[model samples]
Target chain A: MRRIHILCVEDEPEVLEAVVRDLAPFEEVFPIEATATADEARRVVRDVILPRGELGLAICDHILPGEDGVSFMVHLHAQEATRATRKVLLTAQAGLQATIVAVNQAALSHYLAKPWNPDELVAVTRRLLTDYVLETQTNLYPFLSLLEADRLTERIRSGPLPGDE
Target chain B: MSIPIRPLDRIREALQSIPEAQSEVRDFVTGDVLLREGDNPGTISLIIRGEIELLKHAEDGDEYPLGTLRPGQLLGLLSLSSGNASFFTARAASEGTLLTMPDDRFVELLHNRIDFHQVVTPLLLGNLVDRYRRVVRLHLEVAELTRDLNAEKRQLQAAIDELEETRNRLVQQEKMATLGQLTAGIAHEINNPIASLSRAADLLHPQWHKVFGEGIERGLTPMFRQAFELGVTREPLQTEIQRQRTAELARLFPDLPRPLVRTLAQVNPESFAELRSAMQRVPESVRLSLLSQWAATFEAGVLVRNVRVAAERIGGIVGSLKSYSRQDKADEDAVDLRQGINDTLVLFGYVLKKFILVVDLPELPPVRCRPGEINQVWTNLILNACEAMGDTGTLWVCCGVRPPDQVWVRIQDSGPGVPRELREKIFESHFTTKQIACARGSGLGLGLAIARGIVEKHGGRITVSDAPEGGAIFTIFLPTGAAPD
Candidate 1:
């Protein structure tokens, strides 16, 4: 089984800390990566997260220093390697049109408005990551307690693993 | 003597019917006077042909033409009625014929013949009535013309008043625009310094704490820690509490100066006994210096927090101003009106602190608009509500989708409701019910007018009505689709 990576991108240092801190509990299952800009997130995805681990989830802020989060999500959706990644937009001020585009074009999985509750963010991240893992991964034992354990067990029993075939 | 052609024929026919009355036909060349002013000319001369000019003599010895009479018109009829001198001189302007009847024969015919009196009396009355009717018609025509002239004058005055109002409104708008530009510039210039000050304060807090807590072992470090802890938990002392604390500190440290004791009291009013005990442990020579260092460190900690708070406030104001003005940006963008309203509230936070404010805004969809201008609309409305409420009242700002394709924001204030008569006038530029002094101090009565302008530009409508909870309710409805160019 390959390890999965969760990426967080934000422009403000303080906000970025809060976001990564909230995801710290899940680091053992999926390593959390941080970047300040969309361009930096792109570099991390291509050069680091993709080569070593499967990119499973990304939490992005809408406004960045260069190439905003929505465009970055669009670019990620275009690439074949990162196409299955779960996208979440966490922002205080994304306009309606941009959110709509992120939903329709990038297949954005969840939206957490800023000043978000830590529990809510963790719950949504877990759910989206579970969906991604169930669709792509061959083994689901590591994420059994974090996700719907019975459903994953039934899937593992009923279907052959991609590696087994 | 001259006569009109038709009257001569009429006189001739009347004489022939009488058989006893006599009349003579006469001819005159041009410039002959038929009747002269102030001369009797007892015989009646009727014009049978040609033209005669009626003239009045001015005191300046110049004859002014009164009118011209052609054939069939009679002259010297005035003498027939007055039996005295004529009032106007009638002169023949061209050669003409006349029939002259002497006064005695005319009188004799009028008295003896009943038929003659009957024919002449009615003809004279008919002529008089016709002249009177002409005069009456002329008076009526003059009255009608005067009425039309007055109406037109009133219309002209109204147009002038409208023009003056428009000019005043434009001048006020120009002043407000200039003031807005100045505010934006000042806000931009202050932003960087505020950020740096807040950052430095954040950085200095931990370092200052570490040095005061551990850098020194014996020289006032422990006292300083106690003072800092007290300062953090203590409520700000009122004047009475502070005075009592100062007195107690002075009594405890009688040898020290009163100001120093007061400063120590301010920093750590609850830790005064501990401070006194610590001071006794130190040597007499270094006692004052240790207490002074502790007081200074405690004061420094409090000052650091104050500076950070003040800097953050300035930063918030600058952020609100930047968003409100949308400086260095194009006019139109995808704008969240809810965010704009929040920014306006932040700008007005100082004023709103005195009032009970309830802002119930759900997540709203963004609309394409001039964000800065829309923000100004929110600012104006919220400020007006605050001003109306004065020192204490409740203000409610509620926003929601109006459904189908529109979004609406309603701002309500618990002030004296807008008067029924003034509801429409309040949105008009320069129309204010507030005193002139208040207007001069706060605004030029253009706030609502400008708000209406901005809303209308975005294909929206603003309305005001009496609120259910007293005061006024102002509702703004904006279309949710792409704005028409």
Candidate 2:
């Protein structure tokens, strides 16, 4: 069975660690993966995460060593495999123009600035991941505790999880 | 008081005996067209009064007013002499008088009769001289107008170029300000957290050793210390390298938990032999029992040291940024050029990450300067070098104080350089060999020109030459005495 994974792409290992730690609550159901640069992130997506599962969400820093986060997200949006993966831009330096490009071209799901509140980061991750699972996944029980439980529970009560057409 | 000014008296006396000529003149109104261009004027008519306007009709059907003709001017004599057709249209500018005579007989009188010739020749010569002088004056006026227009056009273009340069400076100024301000803001925001994080690590390290024998084995203290130190210092390995290491470690300790083996792979060896010998004491059954506690201690060290190192990195960046961007500093302040250069390097960390910067700035006397502007000069030259190198190459930056009152800085890059012929042309404003990098067009083209402007303003001279490393070398020399007012 393919699992859903959360991908965190940030050049700073310290920031990546902090972000991964915040996403610890969902790690049981949504495995977390980390990479430092766009090149490494793509490799991880292709070789590690995608081979084992679907990428549920991607939280990327706006600036990296090469191939900026917005352009990388735009590339992901262009591809069929990752088009529906939820995206969040985590940056301290993305200007208005870059943010607009992320929004217009990459369909960025959220924006989290530097020195982010851990709880808020977790909440945003939960919402995006829950949104991803509800739209694409049929199994709701695995995410009942870590995700937006009310919405998932309500969804479960309202109808059965949709099966293949 | 006659409405028609009679023809010149000489012309009347001469024509009195001429059979084919009319001595009586005709009076005409302002609206009369004396003769259309290209028409045959059968008689020579003199402008006897008021004025006549000479018009050259254009193909566009618009008449170009050449000039006006006054009384005593011969209208058709020149045309008759040349051919028989009028070359230009002559219209009555104001009410005037005219006279007519047969063209051939008028020519015969002027040629055959000496008295008539003497009388009419002066009038003809006088008119000819006046028309010649007018044409010469018109040419001079046209030439003067053209010269004036060209001078104004050059001035206008110069003004536009100056405006573009001024705008570039302002944008550069704004960019520096924003970078400075952003750095300050980041420092303000992160300083406390960083301070507290480092302090917390400092507080925890000692406290952990106190709980020594409770959960931790006192005999295993050396091994624990080594593991903690290893975690604090080791850099994360590449994925491929880490995987190989993990596989090797698993082969060595086949019975150890996979998690413990993986963790050992990360601590990469200053004391791997010691760890292996120490691990020999633990029975294979209890090794799994010790894994969780050992892993916890190792992780604590890594996380704590990561915070400490990251905190130090943040402090360095903030300090560099503050030094680089104190735009409010007075122009008279004396500063170490090296400090500014280092700060600029810090600010350019993103672009210069892959660059190998060989800085040889030694101790030198403080030079009076605008620190921000001086750093901008550094930024421009460095950026130029970076662009020349196409983002990856070695850059050499150094400064020296001459024994006299001069200080100099040299920036060199290891990239394809400016050709010898183009060295001088590169200093010129708007002279660029690069394609514009962005829409705002900042930094790519205007850099060197503005850099020269700033250096010149500081009473400095800048020059470029070929570097020994097959790249370009830019040198700036400045007065060490005082900042230029």
Highest lDDT: give the candidate number.
Answer: 2
Query: What is the C-alpha lDDT profile of model 2 across B1-485, one tens digit per residue?
Result: 41333348656656666655554577889979988999988778776677989999999999999888888887787678788678799899899787667787788777788876766777777787888999899999999999999999999999998888888788878888887788788888888887898898777776666655355553777567666767677676664465567678878767765545556677767566766666678886776566556666776777877878887887888888788877654456777888999988888876665567798988877878888889888988988887788635888999997657879999999999889999878887778777664312253467788789889988899999997669999999988884433
List clashing residue pairs in candidate 2: none
Runs with alpha carbons beyond 4 Å of true place in candidate 2 = A70-85, A95-110, A131-141, A148-165, B1-8, B14-45, B48-68, B74-133, B148-311, B326-335, B354-370, B386-422, B432-445, B457-460, B465-473, B477-485
lDDT of 1 at B32: 93
* Candidate 1 ranges beyond 4 A from true positions: A1-165, B1-173, B192-219, B222-289, B326-330, B346-355, B386-392, B428-431, B437-449, B482-485
**Pick by TM-score: which candidate is best?**
2
Q: What is the lDDT of residue A55 in candidate 2?
A: 90
Q: After superposition, how far is residue B216 of candidate 2 from its true place, in Å?
A: 13
> Which structure among the candidates has the greatest DockQ?
2
lDDT of 1 by residue, B1-485 (tens): 42222344664577557755566778988999888888998786656788888899999999998677666555677788778898889898999887677777777878989877765565455456546776798799999999999999999988986886677656645654665687788887898798788888777776776877676866656667666655434444443354467667668667765445545666653477677777788888887777777766765665566567768877887777767766424456767888889888887664565577898999887887887678778888888887787646888999998777789999999998898898889988777656664522356777898789779978999999998778999999999894434
